[model samples]
Target: MELRRRYHAKAQPGQRLPDDVWTTDALGVLSSGSKRDRVNAELFRAIAAYRQVVAKFKMGDMAGNALHRIGVIYTEYLKDPDKGFQAYQELLAHYPGTKEAVNALYKVGAYYLEKKQFAQAVKSYRQFVYNYPNDKRVQDGMLAVARCHMETKAYDKALDAYQSYLSKHPDGKHAAFAKAQVAWIRTYHY
Candidate 1:
């Protein structure tokens, strides 16, 4: 109750809770001045309250930002790819037009690639390329799509994607790399 009061006091009238106070260090504060059991209880209560506030918000850039943060924490701090994937997936689903969506798409593709899930990586990169065709990262996404097919032993598909990218972006940042890959793929076929 006291924590809730403090949280509400800091919140602007009709505004959502500020993002800063949810930091792990601040969350640690709930343990101070309490016994082990009491501290755990208070800490969990605070976490639950914060989650409730987070849930009340609409899906968009803000949600994407939160999901990205969660993803990073899970991926880097917790060393939990499954949880991280869920966060990335949520960001992609909720904010497909936001910068976070682009990043989420890249992360999802990379995650699948690392897991050797080449088909899933190809699907993700394809979606990214289609959605953000004009983005500077489009070239990289194109390359990723080709790489996914290559990793999956689909040499023809890899060659086709790379050729398409070269046709559209002859002078792209990845152009030389794509051409090299095309030559490499041709050697396998011939």
Candidate 2:
């Protein structure tokens, strides 16, 4: 790719480029051309370059950003949820304190939910709620747990999850939806 050529063109024997430099090069490649094939090729190139940055600077802020970007590229552009989940898992493992880890944690649950893996989804969502109780996503994470139970026709478990959500976040954004689901479950399902 032209982008890779440009980066290597500027490479010296013993020089360390700033993190922004690599990211900027990646962004240039991503927005360089309009051709789908070209863009796809550049995306792969960008992923590789960013991955190198992560490997070289394990604890840098850019590493976390690059990791999150890799996950997004895998999930959204390549349409490989498994690879995306793996990238997210790696981000969580390596940078558990980063903001990207919080996002990755929730996305793991979403991936499981998309696959109809309710038990795994519940586990991921519960982990998210437990680790990030004060996070803005905690309410949605709790609601997702109940939703997973309801989808699997586990009325009692769903009720319990919804009740737990309400007790913890009585004024949560999803309070009304949780209440409605609870009432419906009690009336018709249970």
Residue-level lDDT tens digits of model 2 in 1-190 = 4545554676445654576755565565555654675567777888998899999999688898899999999999988889999999999898999989989999999999999999999999999999988998899899999999989999999999999999998988999999999999999976
Query: Per-residue lDDT for 143 in model 2?
Result: 92
lDDT of each: 0.76, 0.88
TM per candidate: 0.69, 0.78
lDDT of 1 at 53: 43
lDDT of 2: 0.88
The residue ranges of model 1 lying beyond 4 angstroms of the native Cα positions read 1-53, 59-61
lDDT (Cα, tens digit) per residue for candidate 1, span 61-174? 465666777777667655777878987897777767777778788889889988989889888888888887887888888888888888778899999999999999999888
Q: Which number leads on TM-score?
A: 2
